[model samples]
Structure formats: structure tokens, C-alpha cells
Target: MKLLFLIVLMYMFDQHKGNRLSNNPRPFEDIKREISDYSEVAKKIINLAVYGKAQNRSYERLALFVDTIGPRLSGSKSLELAIQYMYKALKNDGLENVHLEQVKIPHWERGEESAVMVEPRNHSLAILGLGGSVATPPEGITAEVLVVTSFDELHQRAQEAQGKIVVYNQRYVNYGETVLYRGRGALEAAKVGAKAALIKSITPFSINSPHTGIQSYAVGVPKIPAACISLEDAELIARMSSWGSKVVVTLKMGAKTYPDADSFNTVAEIVGSKYPEQVVLVSGHLDSWDVGQGAMDDGGGAFISWEALSLIKDLGLRPKRTLRLVLWTGEEQGGIGAEQYYKLHKMNISNFDVVMESDEGTFMPSGLAFTGSDEARGIMKEIMKLLKPINITQLFGNGEGTDISYWMKAGVPGASLNDDITKYFWFHHSQGDTMTVQNPMEMNLCAAVWTVVSYVVADMEEKLPV
Candidate 1:
């Protein structure tokens, strides 16, 4: 009886393997037909977005917004004004369910600040104090400089770092890898008893300008003044130190941090025709660094999201799921507004069909970076084929934006616009982020791609599987 049972199990296993191989592959003709079905609607969306008044109108409005409000740092009066402006504009544009959700955000001011080389040479350096940094004493902190390329070098020469200002001369490899020094340089330096920390700006190329970003102090570590210096100055300091020169510097900052300020996450929606509760979200952050016009970093992103809705409405097209737009605040300091929204709306997360964000600059439409199940990926691949005419045929997997990351973690499908980010990091958080970097034709193309992808996904018959 045992031998007979073994023979039967072996036969069943072989048959199951053959069936799996045969059934796993989808037919080419079926995929082609699926793509063909959506081709007409895709052409309509693209034509409306590219040649319609919505794109040009959105560009003009974006110019007015950035010029009038300037840099909308979180907790500033400018950020509040920007939010109010969008609220009124969306309502006037005939969008439904426009409102602001309250959020408490961090407030840090960059007062008069300067850095000067006192020893080895007399040179004034360009600097921007990192957000959340503590103010230096009124007289400023003056000490010899210890230069290191990485945290490992700082640890190896820990004793020498004492009673000195550590300068991180780390070169920029990529934003993700090079930004480590800026984010944690202060904590690492403080752990070794350094008086202050100076980090080289995280950009591959620079023209004697410094880029500022947020930095955090680890618990139980002494807080120290931290700031970013120009790439040229960092390299000069490192070269001088290598020649056995005592590089001494004086740093002064009047940065101040106040209590949390009341802010809001601006929201609007175009109600779905069939499934009113089901949602498809498109978003961008409204707050920016205190420098520049914030055009590329988020102004373009925010305006394009709004344009997607405007184009759809003008074309009289409504998807099956509600299309929502969220302009997040306090994204520069961290994803404060987005995190709060996630916590408040987590119970209804299952109703979210898709969340898409365009934080990266909208130079041109390359494709989309999506994160979902294999079945959903196959569906999106077929959908993206409709966009091949505009050179947006690429579809990457496992990429999502910071604002909607919490929802993605909760099993919601997510996507982010993929563009030619060759020059994005160069002007991202610097004074160079103005409307000059934007081209009218490229911006319109980007909006068209965003609109078509969002509409098709929301109109699909079935939800994206978890």
C-alpha cells in the first residue's frame, strides 16, 4: 500500500509542474488587444493635455504663484498664503470638495550667518545653515579644522577630532549616498566631542553656492551647530590640511527654532462617476527650502497635478474612481503633513486605488516608477504601451515617493513620475530653482503623461491586488 501511494504522489507532482508552465504565460494577442482597447482614450487625454488651454494656463498660474509667494518654508506666512491661494483657485476652477486639513509643523528661521577662514589664509566662505541646527554663541565658535572624507575616517581619528570643528569633505557620488554626511555629520562629530560640523554640499557640480537641507541630532548626543559650505571651499580646506597647515575657521549663526506652527494639507477631488468612495490620488509638496523660487523642486510638481484634473474636467471625462489632489506642506523638513494625513485616513486605505507623486522635476516625461503585485505590474505594462507615441514607454518597478510611502507600506498601490533627472539635483534645494529652468513645451508633455496614466488606472474594472 505504501509503494502504491508513493507512485501516485510522483505522478500528480509531474502533472502539476506541466500545467504550471503551460498556464503561467499570457498570450501575446490578448495583451495587444488590451492595449488597443485603451488607445483611443489615451490619444484623447494626450491631445487635451498637450494642445489644450490647461497646460499653458497652469504654467502662467505657476509663475504667478512662485513670484507672489516666493519660497514657502514651513511655518512661514508665505506658505500659508500659498495654501489659501490654491484653495480659492481650485474652487473657482469648478473642482468639488476643496478644503484644507490642519497640520502642526516645525518652524526654524535662518538669521544672519557667516563663515570665515581665520588661519592659513583669510577667505570668506559661502554657507547656508542646515535646518534644525542650534545657534552659535553671540561671539561665534572659532577652532582648528579637522577634515575627513567619511565617518569611518572620523572614527579612526576620533582623538584628534576633540576640541575642533570637523569638516566633511565627502565628494558627491549620488544624492542618496552623498547626503549621508549632511544628515548625520553633526551627530557623528558631536559623538567625538567636536565643537561644530561643516558639511560639503551634496551636489556633483557647483558654482560657489551652498545647498541647505534638514539635519537631525541623535538622542543623548550633544547638539552642535551644523551648516553646509560650498564645494570649492570644502576642497580647498582639505587640500590645505593635507599640506600640514593648521586650518582655523570662525562660524556664526543666529538660527532660531520656535514652537510648532499650525499648517494645512490642501486637498481637492473630482468625484468618481461609478465608485465615488474609491480614490486615485496625485500629489506634490507645497513647502520648499527658504532659498530660491522653489519652481523645479515642487512648484512644477504641484501645478502639474492641478493641471491633470483641469484637463480631465475640460474634456468631460470622468473615471470610475475619485481623483484626488493633495498639496502636502512641511515636506522640506520631513513628510510631516503626509504622515499626519496617513494616520488620520488609514482606516479607509483599502479604498485607495492608486497614489502618484511627482516630486522630481518635470523636465520631460520618461515613464513611471510603480510599486505593486506582479499581476498589477502586468496590467500597468499593458497600459503604458498606449503612451509609446510620446516616447514614454519605460516602466520601472518598486519606486514610490516619500509623501505616499506610508500608504504604500499599508498595501496601497503607488507610482511616481520618471523624468530625465540629469540636472534635478543641481538646482533642487539651491537658489537656482527658479522658473528659468522650465520649458513650456516640456512641462505640457509631462502633464499629458500624468493625466493619461492616472485616468486609465482609475477606470480599470478591478482594483490593483495587494
Candidate 2:
């Protein structure tokens, strides 16, 4: 087999006609063999991160970070503190190019907010004012509730929504489908003169928790107070409305939008030996919703990214391409930080081989979801095979992350963590997104997978062709 591989290499060189190797496709078998050669290195990374000294290091780092910082909401003091803390930690870790790049980010604070059902009964309901929501009058808005299950129903009953608080009891279909209600419920309700908008939390299971997220108001449309209600309350309102009972609620929100504030994208890296300019980027957003410790939503993701760099540095493994760890800000606000970073660095987009993100929960590892050319996907398949030691060598399509989507859309290969996210939405953007939701063993496995994939890709013979 060695003689055959050598002969094949010589034949390829001869076909190149001179000194340079051909850019033509290599056999899938050859790629597999090349990737399999990293099995020993893969085992070393896994052992160190999962069973060796570094075990639970990421989780411990994340616990300290999350507990100390609390919640790193964009444009807040906590976010800035988190940025500074990460910068100092990265420098202390001895990673290269540790610094921050400034970004202008939105600032929306959810102040004291409350809701109470007054018509049918005097009952208080849990509420979390959506980000960027305008405040209600000091005394609050007390009006009849108009419950609608879907936008179609709301539009059909447009006349009924006037002088009322529009309550969207949209069923939980999926994040993409249901999140539309949370994001646009205010705008849609305002179109028909709703006094306020109350959207159901976007989750299949909710323990009376109201999930808060960013909501947008259209220009020329009257901005209305908007907030998210727990699933139980949403269902209660719907049930009352179904029985021809009148439900009236008083809503008061102190939500205020301040001027955009200064923030940063914290960065660190391990410079490559052979191709210093070329990069394999690993990242997760540092900013999160203000409701919880923000541990599950992205704290785990960010720390594991740092762990990948730490693991590589511990092993004294420098790849052919630089490995950069970017902790982005303003990711919850539609990925503003990452968008700015992309615009600033896109001139060298060709030098970026792959951008990896781990926004998904750091649950038990499953595999990866990737977006790239067929050739790149083929290469990734071979690389994943090395992870069989951890039993997480699977690859799906349409790799995505709000932070990395900009690069992926511009044709750069992108990869996002895929794990057991069955309970992700249950705590996302809510007070439930705390350290208790995260598991140390799961985090160790996630860090192992992240390190192995990133190191192998960075050290590979050639970039995964875009």
C-alpha cells in the first residue's frame, strides 16, 4: 500500500508537468487515508480533554465566567466587563494576538415590567419585555385582550384588535416558525392598532418562564409595548377566549432603548508555522440575553472555543494555518458583532479555510452540520472519521450559526456544533439558561470534538476548497 501510494504521488507530480502539484481532485480513498493518519493525534486530544488533566476545565472556566459576569448582555456594563475579563484571560493563557476590536451595538434594557389579568379575575402573570420594546405609559395600558393563534387569524380579526392588547398564542412548531411571532408580533399588532403585543414564549415546554428576545418595529408604524408571556399564561388566555369569556389585562413595561454603545469582539489565536496568514476560525458569541446566567445559550459555546485553543497550546501543536478564537458580541441582536467583523476582515476571506461555531447547547456530542462544496464535505467526512473514538463522527448539511452565517453565505465553508439540543429552547433567552442546565462531562466531550476537528483541519495538507 505504501509503494502504491508513493507511485500515485509520483504520477500526480508527473501529471503536474513540473514542480507544482495539480489542483485537480484527489481520490476519496486517498483523502480518507490522509485523514485517518490523524487518528493518534485525535486520540491524544480526546484523552487529554475528556479523561486527562484538562477534563472539566471548560465547564469550570465557564462556571466562573458565568457566575462572575452573571449575564453579558450587549451594550451593557456586564458585557464590557466580560470582554475585558476574556481579554486578560486569553493573554494570561499565552495565546497570540489577544485583543479586542470595537463594534457599535444596540442597547435595550428591560426594566421593571408586569402584567395582571383584571377582567376575568385578578391574577398576575409572568412577563419579560422583549428587547428594544418601547415603554408603556406610566400608569400602564389596561384593555381587553384579543387572543389569536396565528397571524392569519390576527389579520382576519383586524377589526377586533383595535383598542386592545393583542395576544399571540401561536403554537410551538419550531424556532424558525414560532420565532416569527416573537420578532414581528409587535409590528403586526401595531398595523391594526393594538395597544400592546404579548407573544407566547417560543418553546415546546416552559415552566412558567417567559422567554425574552429582540423584536423589531417597522418605520412609519406606531411602536407598541411588547413582551413575552409564559406558555401556561398564553394557553390560559386562549382557553378563556375560546369559552367566550372576556379577558382584560393591565400591562406595564419600563423597557427603554438607549443610544448604541461601544463593545468589542474579543480575540485570541495560535499562529501557524507554515501558513500564518491562512486561518481556521473557531468561535461563539460572548453576548447573551439578560434574563439568566446565559450559560446554556452561549457561555458553554464560548468557553469551549477557548478550551480548543488551550488544548492545542497544551499539546504544543501548531497547525499549518492559524487557529483563531473569536468571542463575538451582539450576537443575540441579529449577529451585529459578527457582521461587523466579517466586513472588516472579508478582504482576506479567501485565506479563511473554515469558520466553526458552537452556539448549540454543549450537550452530549452528536456530530456536525456543515455548509461547503461537495469536495469540502467529502474532506470533512474523512476528518470526522478520526472522531470515532468518541463515537461522534457524523456530518449533516446546512451548517449554520447567526455569528458565522455571514461568512458561510459569502461562500466560505462553515461548521456548527451538533449535539443533543432537546432541551435547548426550554431555557434559551430565559432565566432558566443557567449553569445548572450545563453538564461538565458533556462540555468535556464537546471541547474534545471541537479541538480535534479544528486542529486536524488547520494542520491538513491543503485547505478545504471553498
- Model 1 clash pairs are none
Q: Give a tens-digit lDDT track for model 2, residues 1-466.
A: 9999999999875543311123665677886888889999999999999999999999999999999999888899999999999999999999999999999999988888999999898989999999899999999999999999999999999999999999999989999988999999999999999999999999999889999999999989999999999999999999999999999999999988899999999999999877788889999999999989999889999999999999999998999789999999999999999999999999998788899999989999899899998888989988888899889999999889999999999989999999999999999999999999999999999999899999999988777876
- Per TM-score, the best of the predicted structures is 2
TM-score (C-alpha, index-matched) for candidate 2: 0.95
User: What is the C-alpha lDDT profile of model 1 across 168-190, one tens digit per residue?
Assistant: 99978999899999999999999
For model 1, the superposed segments whose C-alpha errors exceed 4 Å read: 1-35
Whole-model lDDT per candidate: 0.88, 0.92
lDDT of 1 at 214: 94
